[model samples]
Target: MNRLRTILFATFFYILSVPIVMSVPVSALFGRRAVIRHAHVWARMHRLLYRYIMGVRVRVEGQVPAGTYFFAAKHQAMFETLELQLLLGDPAMVIKRELSRIPFWGWAAMRYGGIIADREASAGALRSMMRAAKALKAEGRSILIYPEGTRVAPGEQPPLQSGFAGLYRALALPVVPVALDTGLVWPKHGPKRPGVVTIRIGETIPPGLPREAIEARVHDAINVLDRERRDYRMVQAPPAA
Candidate 1:
């Protein structure tokens, strides 16, 4: 039965996605904002499918900040990639260069303010990403990044990628750490289970802190929901002085 539901969900999800993906060029014709609006609609459609078809629901704790703040989030599944766009009001997303090369979808993503990072290029990638991110920031858009760089299994907290710190220091925007338990249901490869996924928004950490301090704070804050870790528990950072 669960398998059947998963199949139905995937089937309809991609079928419905065709038109939206195909419409990207038309949306681009209007303008960048129009493309972003189209992307938001796409994200919302996925949310609806998650709720009604997959029997999955989201429960967010704490306020989702408005305006041009930087967001660092836990990445345990592909779920948040789309969901955060809706929750953060279509913030410019930091995504892989590979994703940005996906033909039509890729072109639309760049037009919609995606900062594409070529991971293997190291220093050069960071330079390119910073340029794109700064441009988006100047446009009054918030930035959302999965600091761990890729999805990990539930309870596995990996050190954040160096790019995270570089972007934080350069962007100099307050960072909001978001933790979620989506992997429990939305495993990388399997039938998704029906459950309430909780997204915990941690206190905002001020910008301009040393690399070590900011990385440690974000690491702890984004792992607040990692119950499987023997030492796991929420460690809130003291209010920025």
Candidate 2:
């Protein structure tokens, strides 16, 4: 029955995604705001489908802060990617340039002003991402990035990618560290487990901190949601320096 439910969940998401994908071109013609609004609606619909079809619910810990800032979140599975939109309305996502080159989805991401990075481009990629993030900040849109750069096993801990640190220094915005154990129920590639995915939003780490301080703080913040800790408490942000 679980397997069947998983199949149904995947099918339902893809089916609805087609229309959203198709509307991208038209939304692009309108502007990034239009595309972002459409995407927000899609994310809400996705949350509904997962809840009704798969019995998976989302429980957020802390209130998402207002105004433009950086959100450095743990990437467990594809779950958080979809869930973040619902959580933060429509923050500018930091994604790879290759993802921005895809057909409808890519076009929408590019048009919607996602901060695009090209790892292969080395320093240039970081520069491009910083410039884009700064633009989004000016536009009063928050930015979200997976500090690990890719998904890891639920219980495992990995050092954040160097790009995250660079973005922190260049963008100079307070960084909100988010932690989630979605992978416990939604593995990177496997059958879906039924449970509530808890997203714990940590306090905002102020900018201009040394690299070691920021990275260590973010690393601990994101790992708070790991199963062993089992403490789902809201972590208050320290007073900004």
Candidate 3:
């Protein structure tokens, strides 16, 4: 029964996604903002689908910070990726450069001002990312980066990618570490369980710290949502729309 629901929901999700994702390029004929509008609409539809089809709900505990800041979030599943869009309005997401090469979505993401990072440690790629991120900061936009670079299982503690500290130093903004256990309800690539995924935003860590200091603080902050922790309150997920 669960498998059947998962299959049905997954199919519905992608079917709806084709048009939503394509809207990016179609709207590109208008302007950058138009592309972003499509992106935002896509995010809202994704949340609605998750609620109605998978029985999963999302909510935040601490207040989402305001103004231009670097957001470091724990990556446990794909759910948090969409959840970030809802949490921060039209954020400049730091994603892999490879994703920036996808067909229509890639072209739109670039036009919409996503910061593309190269995981291969190429100096030129790093330089380009820093330049893009700085420009986004100047526009007073918040930046979201998955410090671990990829999704990990619920209980795992992996070191953040090498580029995180560099981006931190380059941006020189207060870092707001966000924690969430979305994987408990939404696995990497499987049927999602029915539950509320709570995202806890820790207090901001100001800039100017040494690399070691910043990484240590971020690592501890995001782990607050790791499976072993019992520090937060859970609420009933809201009903499907």
Best by TM-score: 1
197: Cα error in model 2, Å:
0.7
- Candidate 2 has its poorest 10 consecutive residues by lDDT at 227-236
Residue-level lDDT tens digits of model 1 in 1-241: 7787789889988999889989999988899899999998889889999899899999999998777899999999888989988887788999998898898888888899999876785888889899999999999999999999899998798899888999998899999999999998899998888999999999999999999999999999999888534443334445559
Candidate 2 stretches with Cα past 4 Å from truth are: 227-241
| Rank order (by TM-score, best first) | 1, 2, 3
When 1 and 2 are scored with TM-score, the better candidate is 1
Tens-digit lDDT track of model 3 for 151-205: 8888787988878899899999999999999888888776677889989988999
**Residue pairs in candidate 2 whose N, alpha carbon or C atoms collide under 3 angstroms:** 203-237
Give per-model CA RMSD.
5.9, 6.5, 6.1
What's the TM-score of every candidate structure? 0.93, 0.91, 0.91
What lDDT does model 1 reach? 0.89
Distance (Å) between predicted and true CA of 168, model 2? 0.8
Candidate numbers, best lDDT first, in rank order: 1, 2, 3
State residue 206's C-alpha deviation in candidate 1, in Å.
Answer: 0.3
- Candidate 3: the clashing residue pairs are none
Candidate 1 lDDT for residue 21: 88
Q: State the weakest 10-residue window (summed lDDT) of model 3.
A: 227-236
Candidate whose lDDT is highest: 1
